[model samples]
Target: MKSYLAPKFIIERDTERCINCKVCVNQCSFDSHYYDADDDKVKSRIGKCVGCHRCVLFCPTQALTVRENPLDYRANYNWSPEVIEDITKQAESGGVVLTGMGNDKSQRIYWDHLLLNASQVTNPSIDPLREPMELTTYLGRKPDKIDIDKQDPQSIKLKTELAPQVKLDVPVMFSAMSYGAVSINVHKSLARAAVEMGTLWNTGEGGLHPDLYKYGNNTIVQVASGRFGVQPSYLNIARVVEIKIGQGAKPGIGGHLPGEKVTAEVSSTRMIPHGTDALSPAPQHDIYSIEDLSQLIHALKEATNYTKPISVKIAAVHNSAAIASGMVRAGADIIVLDGFRGATGAAPKIIRENVGIPIELALASVDTRLRQEGIRNQASLVISGGIRNSGDVIKAIALGADAVNIGTAALVALGCRVCQQCHTGKCAWGICTSDLFLSKRLNPDIGARRAANLLRGWSHEIKDMLGGMGINAIESLRGNRLHLRGIDLTDTELEVLGVRMAGN
Candidate 1:
């Protein structure tokens, strides 16, 4: 079992007042409390508590109280409440903030501000249960037109074999998160879930773990600047190859895996010196310009023998449209736009809140620019960075995305409280930490099943939304501006969104 020496805050329950309702047990997203069948009492494994206050707030009897251990350090001027709390815990243990995935602070989650529309009674909502509800989606370029030679069927040759469609059972995809950030068990769980659910999971810029090769057909290998654990064999073993330009949490800033967290195994996989920081440089050495981007794309294609689709992922920014256009021109088969306000393992507070644009505006602008340039159909669009539920997924598609990538939501399904302490590595919930004992708290089978259930639930809801719109298939919803309308938006916003007045 992995060992740690950090002081912990414990949540105690008033045994006299505890009625064994299991309310606190169920309400605690961290799974800190459980029913002790032998003792006939509710017990809290307080070490798992992240002080989210969910249990305290939800306890009907107000019987729960959380207190910091005396050993917990007091904050000094150098460390604010948040910083002190993080450092105290991590400093005592000497570990990275063990977060599951994504940044999840109270930063602006734009999806909430921008809402979806359901067909009015006048438009007539179709019954999805009775009718055929279509959620099947293809994630690749669509041909503008199919040429036919009716006069000489045998003589006519095809322009080229069309790119194969990335057949998603649902429009939702598991977002990129590295194996090192999470655990190999966690990676296996995600891969197994993806294959079972007919979706895809991204192998974050961290190279593919050899153990996960079985799920290759449903995997998308990611290549980032550091080239950590990347090789021709790794590149060749994926359904799609994604080039990560930036992340929503820290757009221009790169990731730093402190030397302390670099285990021998992790060091070997990443091809870095043991016990030294594994720094992913902010900018790729090969990609200085759009032409340079093309060279890297070609290199990957050559390495993979051009079998897998190539995707470029960029953080949403003010110039996202221009950047996306350049990526398409750089031979990207798909483009993933990660919005501002997305979750992260660890990022400076200012950068997390200020660096990137909202997914809504970025999606609209990029789609409009690509369509205007007559190149929208040349590649697929996948939007990430705070996609919360099925409604957000449907709205993203109608706004012009081919699919949605979810990191935060998937982690929630696997038991994350979003305590915002991921960087400190002592994830009370086993989902994020690498500690053997803490990690065992999450059973990979159960976690993977839960994730699969969440995806299945969302798929059903998406189908219901599409059916309510009188739309039969997910493809019909792709870039269907006519089915959408803006609310509380200014004239300029409406113009940018390509939506007119509600009645019109």
Candidate 2:
């Protein structure tokens, strides 16, 4: 007795081009293809396909085609097929519906609404190839003002010294993806890529793999509510230690690594019992207030002997600006703001779709609040959630982000199709599954190299954009909202973004 829900994808094979090599049957991990021994031909269970197209690539004969299944039900704009199907799924399973990747709905993409300005006769644009365009960014606290020693006027020795900063050659870095959520090779690729690109990769909640200790210089180890794999060594090994207060995908909720996904290796890394649910409590019980946050922030600094910067990460909620201010005053040298459209390995579908605001608004608001409070120099701001390309990175910097973290895009480059089946523990791509067979699909060297290439290409694009703006350094773009102009946004949107209309 199979469920009557319509299949989302249709797997078609051209009979004339079929060589009967059975490669399509063997390649698909979803069991969509099978050999019919009685008929001596290959057949497909179209309803089972997630349309990842992995088999299409392996089919040497080019006989396979995957497409979206035609909708049979009457079209209604409000209660659409996806909504109806989700209801059926929840009714049948009696479980929370799950999805992977990011939000798939049409929402206000502020990046599209904001346009970048270019230099003209008054300020001629510089050629990136011929001029010196700087893309390197340092993430950490900065001094508000410099005081020089009068005795050594020629040397101009600083009275106040600078704090520890993680210098990144590129403003884009790979975001957090936990060990139980993504394969070890994925982590290795991120670590290797960060090292090669001169950036840092965040170890999301999950503990750092022992093999990756060598790349600790480029690692940003996290201490979330679960405190998974958090130790003195964890604090000391990384260039920065981040505290994960909440995530954009499921704000006010905790992380859920299903018992089914808790493999032996994952258990060892998370220090939890095998085949048991690893649920992080919604709030760090110790951190009941902002003062409590200060305790933990200083604790990490103390453990690291004040050698590394401490970052506090929070979801961009309605009061994100106020919360960011508290975090900066609480001894945080860096602040990470994750918006609603952020990707998650697993989260309740309702919470994923309906919670939090966009990163664009959150970043603009938080940066303004901090600057107004005169704490802008107290901490560096890093933002994430639905950052699609180099343009998005450039726009984020213009809106006041020191750096941007990219998770879904990096995974896409590593062959992820975003089929939204991550909760089932059977990711079609090797990026987000613990299954040994599936994990083998991603080669670490290739994955790392691909990640590096993405950063390199984006870095070049950033330089190009900067040169067009007549700005020589990346810091000049930070919080420089004057360089951006709004298109069709409302009065409030423009005011929140601190930008003018395109014409004015």
Candidate 3:
């Protein structure tokens, strides 16, 4: 069958400046660039380009230009170019259209609709450079009230017993991206960067490699439906244990790591046979009800000797607020909400774009519900999915997120271009592939420095934003919707976000 699918990108190489150095020939993993021996020139197969820009960056002469292929299809509002292409792909392959990364649709980004308040006449803004600003965040269950005795007027005693907590210098942590789906070096970079930034990185259900045990203090090992590598030592070595109930990209479904990505190390770490695909079930087999979930939580606490916080991660669906309420009552010390925009190594394109609610709505509703129920202190809340910058982080904090996770942003820091071709396992940047040759392209030291630098920069920006609001500490911003104002938002949106419209 002659495919009707048009090339997604167009690549042009200038002959005047072309040196035919074969740099692009070796750089592009997609086989878009080629060396023509007969013509003694470098050429391109434009149809093969995924637009990752590997050749453009490595090109010394600046002779290459890659841009979106302007294939002029008849304009149809209801049927978009992407839609048509997707239909075409399915017709040819007769398989589910798979994509990598988050939803690229034109959904309303709540972060853009919201604006932060700045102090002026009534309140004076403090200069972060001159004043001591606090971004310290603690994630875990908090006591409803503390009973203290000021015995000597100098010392206090008789404090209520507190649950285990994971202290972070900043209210930002790395999101879970499993080992087999990505590479070992990616995990190494994330772990090292988490340690450097005084934050934590999650080992997303794929299990922890032996090389990462040293960074366990900054690790959050995950237990999912598959229970790939849930061993005693794995639980004991981490600062926190997270049960991944669902993810935002493809909620209500399981995860699949292609057999090709499961290398020997991944097999050893996950306790699976070599080259076998790892498929996590949609639900934990033993967890049929909230009671079952509570039991598992208690069992994990017992396994950890009551030392670490147990976090339950769920995708932000319509009833997220209600679900989160149950999780806290079930003894979850921390609850993680992954929004629709969360990234994944692979997922059905339809599910990634169609499923899950926005994190903003879910966060506000959950926080409000928990507060109304007087159980807000029972667990801390962390949100992920589509957190782009420090501004998003601060807004999320204002909306009641204890902290925010950055998955795609962190990958971008480590040389990812958001090409959305991660499912192919032919990543030229080496950030998303398990192939040894491509994996080596990403140096762990460099990747760690880049990711850590991103956190440092964002933390500074968060402090600056907090100072502008006359808030010296990030904790003060939690659930303070008064500091947030909606712009061009509907009345219902304003109500749902718990914020007044701009110019109110």
Best by lDDT: 3
lDDT of 3 by residue, 1-504 (tens): 999988999999898988999999999999998999999988999699999999999899999999999888788999999989999999999999999999889999999999999999999998999999999999999998988888778887867888898899989999999988888889999999999999999999999998899999999999999998889999999999999999999999998888888888888988889988888988999898889899999999999999999999999999999999999999999999999999999999999999999999999999999999999989999999989999999999999999999999999999999999999888999888888888998999999999999999998899899999999999999989999999999999999999999999
Query: What's model 2's overall lDDT?
Result: 0.90
**By how many angstroms RMSD does model 1 differ from the true structure?**
6.4
Q: What is the lDDT of residue 105 in candidate 2?
A: 73
How many clashes (backbone N, Cα, C below 3 Å) per candidate? 11, 0, 0
lDDT of 2 by residue, 415-504 (tens): 887787777777767778888788888899999999999998998998999999999999999889999999999999999988899999
Candidate 1 residue 433 Cα shift, in angstroms, is 2.2
User: Which tens-of-lDDT digit does each residue in 41-74 have in candidate 1?
Assistant: 8889847776756678678888898877556446
**Model 2, C-alpha of 119: deviation from truth (Å):** 0.8
- lDDT score for candidate 1 against the true structure: 0.80
* Off by more than 4 A, model 2: 150-156
In order, candidate lDDTs are 0.80, 0.90, 0.93
From the highest TM-score down, the ranking of the candidates is: 3, 2, 1
C-alpha positional error of residue 475 in candidate 3 after TM-score superposition, expressed in Å: 0.8
As for TM-score, the candidate ahead, 1 or 3, is: 3
